[model samples]
Structure formats: C-alpha cells, structure tokens
Target: MIEVTNLSKSYGSTQALRGVSFRVESGEIIGLLGPNGAGKTTMMRVLTGYLQPDEGQVTVDGLDVLTDTLEVQKRIGYLPENAPLYPELSVQAYLKMIANLRQIPAADQPACLSEAVRATALTDHLTRPIGELSRGYRQRVGLAQAILHQPKLLICDEPTASLDPTQIVEVRRLIRRLARHSTVILSTHILSEVEATCDRVIILLNGEVKADARLADLSATTDAVLVLAEGAPDATKDLKALAGAENVEAYPTPDGHQYRVRGAGGVDLRPAIYELAHTRSWPLRELRRDVRTLETVFNELTTQVRRTSADTGEMKAGRRGSDQNPSASHLSERR
Candidate 1:
C-alpha cells in the first residue's frame, strides 16, 4: 500500500508537480497517466525515494519514505525509464549482484537469480552482456534486476518504451502476473498500456491530480453510449424520442443501418429501445450499449484542462506537457 499527499516540486521558475496526491491499494496495479512533462516521472522519483519531494509526504505500508528511506527502498523495486544497468554485466550476473545487494541470503542467490530470469523471460540471455542484448531484452534485464529483490511494491517507469508489439504484450503480461503478488505503480503515457494493465488510473496534468478512479468508473462518468443494432428501416426518429439521448447519428451500411447515440447524463435507454423493437417488431438485427475506450475518456477529460488554460491566457502555448527537471529548492519543498 502507498499514499502520497500534496506532492509539489519545482525546477527554477517552472513547477513540475503542484499538489499532486493519490493512493495505491495493496495488490492493485495503478497506472500513472499523463502527457510528457506532466510530472509523472517526478512523482515516481519521489515515491521510489530516488528524489525527495519539496512539499509532500509519501508512505509505503505506513513507513515514511523520507524518514525510513532504506526500509522503504527495501520494500520497493524500481525500474526507471532507462533502467540504469551496467552494460558490461551479463544478465545472470547482474541480477545476482542486485540480489546480493538486496541482502538476499547467499544460499538463495541461485533461486533468486533464476526467478528473475524466468519471470522476465531472460533465461536464454543469462550469459549475454546487457549492452549486446536488443532493446526488448535489455528491458527484461532491467525488470529482472528490479524484482530480484522480491520487493512488495514494484515501480516501473515506461517499462515498455522501446519494445516491439510482441515484446510489449509479453512485458504487459509479465506485469499483470507480478501484480497478483505485488502492488504495482506503472508510469506511462501510453493509453493502451494503461487500459490493458491497470485496474485503476490516476491522471496527472501540469503537476496536479486531474482524475483518480477505476477504469470502469471513468468510463461510466462519460455519457457516451454505444449502439449496435441491425434494423429494417429508419428508426432514427423513434430512437431519438427515447430518454436522454443526443447526437443521434445514423449511417447506412450494407448490412443494415448503424446508429451512434450520446446521452447528456447517466441514463439507461436499453429498456426503451428493447420495448420499441418488441412493439413494432422492427426486424432488429442487433442492439447493445457502447463502451467508451480509455483513449476516448482520456481525451475527453484532459480537453477541459487544455482549453481552460488557453482561454485564461495562462498557458504559454508551448508544445504542451513537456518534462522538465526539478531544482534543488523544490527538492527541499518535497521534504
């Protein structure tokens, strides 16, 4: 379990995080979602004790990160974006080294190293130099070292940054498997990754917490309706008359007519549509509610943030959401 409150960090005149706060429950896989420079890495650094926050507190299983950093580090496994590793070290040797550093008993080294290798699918690359491995293999090696210590919490920053599609699926599967036993906090800008791997998400924007909720909850919050139906004829007029529907668009397809419906609030129209079909027997082919994808929800939520800043003339109008380094003074504020 982890809790972070009011975390703030700044670098010179630019602020990296402003009052960001969130919690990760035990055995939950949480995605830290944001655009580049949204302070995702900054928050991760503080949580992992790689960097101290300027004006917030972080606790891991009730242990203060700042006061009990060593203990906190012992309970956490961190794989940074670059996964700092020695290029010359062989895969097996590097994990063995990390296991030893983690104070894994000398006799358990072999098992620990083997577990890391197997979990990351690095068995074949055990003897290969880290620098010689492909980007995907190198990422596995990085992950291997992180879990070698068997920490209770796993923190990965862009764990699949350079991997191909196959490798990305493999790594995502691996993370999900690991989360069955460990709390995972994965920081990524990839929406699909979050949708595939995270049970809940915390969206950060301009160094602040924008949204924190479960994937299902966020989806429900958006009043988007999914419609799947095959019918004989133009039922658009009848469908629109149903409760709480808007943006009702019907397009003709070879199979039948397809319709997309949007509602202004959380309204259920399935019953009405079903009754209409039953009463008229309109030769309905199919009908179902539309579920908004994580991508759509993410865009919908952040659009307001971007527009508000632009309208208020507060946003400098840069490329938008770029990662910048935090200064020492901000580090002090983190404490």
Candidate 2:
C-alpha cells in the first residue's frame, strides 16, 4: 500500500534519512521502530506529503506522493506526536469542523462523523468539551478527526507518547481497531508498542534502515538456558554430545545448576533441553530462551551498527538516545 525507495532527506549538514527503503502491504500494521533522531518522524512527514524527500521516490497505492500531493493526502489520515486540537471545541463540534476542512460533502458528513466516532469509541463523549476530557479521550478525538474521512492509509507518529499505563493500553487497542479502516504505519521508539500492535517493523538507526521484518521473526539469540533441580546428575558429558549443541557452560544457582546452551545461528534449543531432561529423568526447574524480542533485535542491530562505526572512527560519541535499556525486556515499561 506504501512504497519508499532510496529515500534521503537532510537539514543543511545533518542528514535525517539516508537511503531508507521499505514497502508496506495492504492492511498491514507496520511499526517504524527507532530511537530519537533516527528519522522516523522525517519518514512520516515525507510519506504524508508534508515534507518532500531530498532524494528518492515515495508512492501510496501507486500514486506519486510528489506529483499527486492532494490526491495522496486524500487517502491518508495522519495523527502527529502532538495532535493539533482546539481545547474549547466540543468533540462533536471539533469533528464537524474537521469534516468541513477535509471537504467532506455536507450530505456525507453525518455518516462520516458517525463512523469515525463509533470506530474510536467516542459516541458517549461527543458532547463534552475537548479540554474536559482526559488525555486518552483527547487522543481519541485526534484519531477520530484523522480517520473522519475513512482514508486508505493511516500514519500515526508516536500515537501513545505520554499517556498513563491504562491510557496507553486504551490508545493502543484503538489503533489496532483503526487498522480495519486503513493500512496503519505508526512510528515509535517503544518496543512493547510494536510488540503489542504491529505485524511488521522497520528498524531505523543513524538515519539508515537497519532491519525490517515480521514482528514474530525477530530473534536476537537462539541460546537456551536450563536449570536443573539441586542434586540432579551432571549432564556435562551429555550436553557435549548433544546434536546441534555448539557450546555449553554451567553455573551454580541458589537451588540448582544453570546451563547456558548455545547452538548454531537461528537454532532453537528449548525442545532439545526438554527432551534431554525427560530422557535423563533429570528434575528440571526452569527451561527458557536466553532472549527473544523486538527489543533484543533492536539492541543487537544498533550495537552492531555502532560498533562498526566506532571501529572505523566514523561514529561520534554523546548522541542522545534511549538506545539501551536496563529493564528485563531491554525496553521501557509503560509504568
């Protein structure tokens, strides 16, 4: 539904996007995953026809974004990081104003408004003033206006930026529902947002495309860890002889021995560990993967990119970003 090819953009000396290329299929919810200054917003702007790329081609549903600017805008619904809204206007009044601005015909306005309100679940709050609603409700108002015309493509930049945990979940769920009306592409640095909402993700780093794949395909490591109940017989010899086991290391835990089993790239060792435990009658307390998440893939790719740049003295230090997190998932929790 969307195509970007060798897209590059810059602000004077600083490049914001460099040869970024990707495609989005119809009805797919894609996450433009990146840290701050990773050109996510720039890409969003370019796609929405708000900013022209310094170089490259961008098309939406086979129409050129540059030449068919107004036509392209007609098929896109955009909700930026800070949604443009009027505090004094009632939700019903606000949506009416947007419909007029969108050039939605008078005869079709009520149906459009009704559909958008129902999709965003804003029916009950339609008569309330915008400022009187909570941030979550205000976000719904923003989304309602964006999709007021039922566009074919929806571009949301940081749709869940600053809401509380409950509000975040509410907004995320709403974005998912909006997918039924449009092909959604949302830009965010939050890994959990991508995990919870997106079918695929495009990772951006230093203004370059680092990785793009289905969310379920992201796996940073294939290693599995095994913890045997205390007093279980040593499996050091068995582990060495195990098929697909390239390396194994053992450490003593408080109540058991922990084994880190490594295998060839992309190999899954959890099933093997289970089978081994069953065959040897070894009492097992825990068997799990060492790591598997979009955050892991994000970190692994960013680290590799930074390392290569540093090795060649092409990387400068002190770039502000939340590239690494200390949380268990290596991502910030909504809390």
Candidate 3:
C-alpha cells in the first residue's frame, strides 16, 4: 500500500534520513522501529504530507505522495505522538471538527463519529472536555479522531504511548482490527508492540534501514535454548558433541547440573541428549529450549550499530540504542 525509495532528508548539517527504502503491503500492519531522532517521526511526517522529503519518492496505492498530496492525505489517518487536540473541546465536538475537516460526508458524519468513539472506547467521555480525560483516554480521543474518517492508511506515531498495560492491550486490539481493512504503519519504541501487533517490522538505525523482516520469522529462532539437566559435570562435554549443539554453559546443581545450550534456530539436540541420558541412566532433571525475546533482538541490532559507528570513529552524540521504552508509554502508567 506504501512504497518509499531512496528517501533522504536533511536539516542544515544534520541528516535525518539517509537513503531509506521500504515497502508496505496492503492490509499489513508494519512497525516502524527506531530510536528517538532516528527519523521514524520524520518518515511518518513525510508519508502524511506534513513534511516533504528532501530526496526520495513516496507513493501510496500507486499515487505519488508529493504530486497527489491531498489524495494521499485523504486516504491516511495520522495520530502524532503528542495529539494536537483542542483542549477545551468536548470529545464529541473534537471528533466532529476533525470529521468535517477531513471532508467526511455530512450525511455520514454522525455514524462515522459514533463508530470512532465506540472503536476507541470513548463513549462515556463524549461530553467530557478533551483536556479532562486521562492520558489513556486522551490517546483514545486522538485515535478516535484519526479513524473518524475511515481512512485507508493509518499512521500512528506511538499509538499506545501513554496508556497502562491494559490500555496498551486494548489499543493494540483496536490497531489489529484497523489492519483488517486498512494498511497500518505503527511507530513505537516498545519492541513488544511490534511483537504483539505488527505482522512485519522495519528496524531503522542511524537514519538508515537496519533490518526488514517478518516478525514471525525473526521470532522463530532455532539455535538458542535455556536448558536444565541433572548429570555429571563431564556430561556437559559429551552433550556438547551432539549435532546442532554449538556452545554449552554448565553450572553444577545439588543433584546434577544446569546447562544452557546455544546453537541454530531449528537445531533440536534434545533427542541426542535423551539418548545419552538413557545410555548412562543419568537423572536428567530439566531440558528446555531457550527462547529469545524481541527485546533481545532489538538491543542486539542497536548495540551493533552503535559499536560499528564507534569503531569507525564516526559516532555522534545522538546515536544510541533504540531499546529504551518511550516516555509516553510509561507516563500514563504511573498515573
């Protein structure tokens, strides 16, 4: 539904995006992963026509974003990190204003507004002022306005930024539902958000594309396992020889031992271990596969990027790992 080619943007001496390129398929929810100042927001802004790229081509549904700016804008629903809301406006009024501004059909405005409010679970706050709502509710209001027009593309920069865990889940459900009909580009600092909500993820680092792969594929690792076994200390060496066993870290236990085996993603040396255990009649207590998490994957990528820059002596002050959780995601949780 969206395609970006050789996109580059610069502000004075600072380069925000460098030769970034990616594609988004229709009805696909893509997570735009990056640290602060990593050009995620800039990309979103360019896609939404709020900011024009210095160099690149952006197209949505085969139409050029620059040439067909209005059409593209009409097809997209954007919820920026900090929602630009009229604080004094009641929830209902705020949505009505956005609906009208988006040129939603006058006859369908009421139903559209009603649908958005219901989708975001803001029905009870219809008459309440936007400012009076909690951060979670304010986020809901922002989301309500975005979908009020039923745009074909939804670009949310930190959609669940200021909500509690429960609220985050609720918002993720809403986004999942949104993906049923429209393409979604959700920018979040939370790797878990990508794990939970996105079908695919694009990791952006230092203004460039670092990784672009399906979430399910990356989440399916074959080489790492958290294992526990009760056997003699020498058993660790024998077990390490099993096919697919790359490295084994062993710790002694009162009964036997604890072993963490690392190898290939699909490597299953469990049967080999079982065979060895049976031959020796050793008491095997625990044998489990280690599962790598999204956090680990994200940190590994960002840390590698940081180290590479440091090695070349080209590191900048702003360069950092993208694994840190966003401020807004934690802000509302505290409240």
Candidate of highest lDDT = 2
- lDDT by residue (189-257, candidate 3, tens digit) is 667788889999898776798889887876675443333444344667776777777777665656666
**Would you estimate the TM-scores of all the predictions?**
0.75, 0.77, 0.76
lDDT of each: 0.78, 0.86, 0.78
lDDT of 2 by residue, 1-335 (tens): 99999999999998999999999999999998887677889999999999999999999999999999999999999999899899999999999999999999999999999999999999999999999999999999999999998899999999988889999999999999989767999998778888899999998887899888887655555678899999998887888788988888777889989887877776888888799889999998999887657755566666676668778876521223455535423232121
True lDDT of residue 211, candidate 2: 86
Candidates' RMSD to native: 9.4, 6.8, 6.9
Best by TM-score: 2
Q: What is the C-alpha lDDT profile of model 1 across 78-149, one tens digit per residue?
A: 999887888999887788788877889998888878887888888888889989998878888888888888
Candidate 1 TM-score, true structure as reference: 0.75
Cα misplacement distance, residue 113 of candidate 2 (Å): 0.3
> Ranking under lDDT, best-scoring first?
2, 3, 1
Write down the worst ten-residue block by lDDT for model 1. 326-335
Which segments of candidate 1 are over 4 A away from where they belong? 220-266, 269-290, 312-335
